[model samples]
Target chain A: MFSIASSELIQIFRNRLVLITSLIIPAAVSAFFVRQHETYADLGSLGYIAAIVLFTVAAFGLYATAVTTLASRRQNLFLKRLRSTAEGDAGILAGLLLPVVVLTVVQVTAILTALAVVAGAPANVALLVVAVLATVAMMIGLALATAGLTNSPEHAQVTTLPVTLGVIAMASWVGITGTENLAWLKRLLPGGAATELTMNAWNGGVAVTDSLLLLAPTLGWVVVAVALATRLFRWEPRR
Target chain B: MSTTPVIEVERLNLTYGDFHAVKDLSFEVRPGELYALLGTNGAGKTSTLEVVEGHRRPTSGTVRVFGHSPDDRRAVRPRMGVMLQESGFSPDLTVRESVGLIGRLTRRTDDVDRVLDVVDLTGRAGRKVSQLSGGEKRRLDFATAVYGTPELLFLDEPTTGLDIQSRDAVWATVDRLRENGATIVLTTHYLEEAQQRADRIGLMHQGTLHREGTVSELTHTLPGVIRFALATPVPPLPLHAVVDADGKVVVESFELQKDLHLLLGWAQDHAVELRDLAAGPTRLDDVFRAINS
Candidate 1:
């Protein structure tokens, strides 16, 4: 597992296009959102802006990375080759996804810290941590589920569009009109509860009951995403 | 030191929807022996190999490697190495890194340079996988398969992209590995490799094991061929033989030596000069051709 992970990191760094694009997308999204937040000129809206930015970073950046990497490995028969070794599916999955998750976490932390310095600290640090964990899990599950439908890395752009647009739209909608008066929508759609949780974490108005209420749907998305991924994931390229 | 077979497949079957790729195939690869599996295209050879490699599940029957199911990867994988027709390496990874990574994933320990040197690829270690020529990539595939001196190795068309010298070098390496008590399973278009090296072979055709045995056993199924031109028509030959359109006597004889001796004596008696005389036992190619025929 460690071998696969180390090799993957080296390969990622060597591919100048992937490395540059992965870095530029997150950094640019962070910069854009941070600059845009200045127009509101209010500290409370900082969390809402931060949530949307992180959602974009996680949804489009990390999700696309995982899906593309997994699909490419499958299509090229790299995964089939690895399956012949001592590398188990769990270990392989963790090895491939952990780096992406760690990098996202680091990038998110940096952005949040910068925002805190410019604005003020998050209202609820505990809630913020929960929201971050829930969102990352949800995104990774969604990525794997989406990857199952992707035939190759080349086809990833078209296949990934629906989920990418869906995540962005959900986060954008949540940002525009806070998660209120839409109970079923929050519980059902992919990124719905995740946005609500993050925004609530930022706004600092969550009671224990409210946190549980937000937690249920986020966990539900994670479960559904994982089940779909396992059911649909293909170790070989589509013929 | 035990003599149990390294691989055993019994009544194996694999189907892809309505298409049956392998059918009731059975073969055993004994310990420390080089076994070659050969077939025409769509002969179910690849399907059989993939089942043994645990890359695909059999539709029916069983495959065991090292006394455990090939799908029981934890036990069988550490001791086995496979060189697929395509290495499928990431374009950006360096050769050394790819080798090291596979070795690590298979949980094998080795001196990387030593393994690279085995394939004569130590100098190309720093090159990216994409930068390496096709032949070099093939060598990298071989290097990794033989990296830790795996107990059982599968080489599928292992020398396809190789030049003559590299092919010789690879065969030499395989020779060395066999000497080290490694069990080898080879698949190749080069029948001579099987003829010269395989301790035993399994020939497949159209999803069935067409023939399986020692080289001589397979070739003996067909008759040795003898061809010669006669300077002049002589008395009836002492053996059964037919003349071709060019007036060349062609004899397909199972008892080649005796018939040849009889023919030579008749030629001596008749003072008939035998021209363009050639005699040889059946080759693996002949056996393969017979299957196709």
Candidate 2:
């Protein structure tokens, strides 16, 4: 698995287009949000900015990149090549996605830390960490499921738009509006519970028990995404 | 050197929706043997190979590699090396990196540099796969397949895009591996390769095993040919012969050597020059052509 991940890391840095889309673009977008934190914080809250930045990195950096990587590998038969080895299917996938997952965690951590430094630390750092981990899991799951529907790296652009945009939009709606009007609906959307959890962690005044309950919905998305991935994900492209 | 088969397939059937890509195919590759599976286009050779390699499951059949299921990668794969029909390396990776990655995944240890040297790709080691030419990419693929010198190797059209020298090098490497008692399963369009190297050959057509045998066994089913052109019309030939459109005399003979001697003696007695005299036993290509018929 480490061998595969190391090779993947090498390829990721070598491809200029992938580097830009997966790393630079998300970092730049997150930097802008961090730089303009004050304005966005006034519109929503500091926690809201945190959630937006997290979703930005997750959607583009982790999610979109993984979908494109998998689709590209499948189209080129690299996945098939890997399977020709002694590695199990699960190990192969873990190896291929490990680098992207680790990178997303690092990026999210760095960006969230910067947000905390400028806009005051969150009320519950532990809860915020949980939110980040859960969000990453959800996004990775969705990416696997989306990769099945994607034919090529070029097709990934069209196939990934809905989920990428939907989650970001969900983060925006739940983050900016505070989830009071349609509380149940807000918590039920894919990214809604995670966004609200991030807000409560950073902006306080919510009960710890209430915030912990938010995990159920987020975990539910994980289950749904994983189930969908199992059915949809393909190791090789269509014959 | 055990007689037990190294690979086994029994009544294998593979279907893609409504299309039956492979029918009830059954063949076994014995230990320390080079078994070549040759077929016409759309003959299901690739599909059968994929099932044996555990890339796809047969709709109904049993495929065992070394007494274990082929899908049992942890058991079968560590001892087997597969050279796919296409170049599947990430184009962004250097040839060396590609070899290293695949080599490690095979769970068989060998010097990466040595494998590159085997394929004469040491000079192109640092070059990314994207920068290599078609032939170079093929050599790179060959390099990886021989990385650990596994017990069993699958070479799928291993010489398709290769140049003459590269092709010779690949066969030479296979020769060395065979010397070490490696079992090889090969599929190629070059019938001559199979004829020269295979201990046994399985010919597939329309998703079925059309024929299976050694070179002599397969070729012997078809008659050998003797061809010669006469400068001047002679008396009735000693053997039955047909004059083609170009005035070339053609004789189909099961007894090639006997018929050739009679024709040579006839020509000598008449002092008639037999131009372009060619006589040989039936070739593998003839067997392949006969499949369609």
The candidate that wins on TM-score is 2
Q: Per-residue lDDT of B1-293 in model 1, one digit per residue for the tens? A: 77998999999999999999999988999999999999999899988999999988999998999999998878998899899887778777888888888878888788888888888888999988888898998999898888788999999999897999999999998888888899999999999989999999999999999988999999998999988997666778788888877778888899999989988888898888889999999999999888867
* Model 2 bad stretches (over 4 Å): none
Can you write out model 2's per-residue Cα lDDT over B13-81, one digit (the tens) per residue? Answer: 999899998999999999999999999999999999999999999999999999999899999999999
How does residue B280 of candidate 2 score in lDDT? Answer: 94
Counting only residues 3 or more apart in sequence or on different chains, how many pairs clash (N, Cα, C under 3 Å) in candidate 2?
A: 0
Give the local distance difference test score of model 2: 0.93
RMSD (Cα, Å) of candidate 1?
1.9
- Estimate every model's Cα lDDT from 0 to 1: 0.84, 0.93
Pairs clashing in candidate 2? none
Per-candidate DockQ values are 0.73, 0.91
Docking class of 2: high
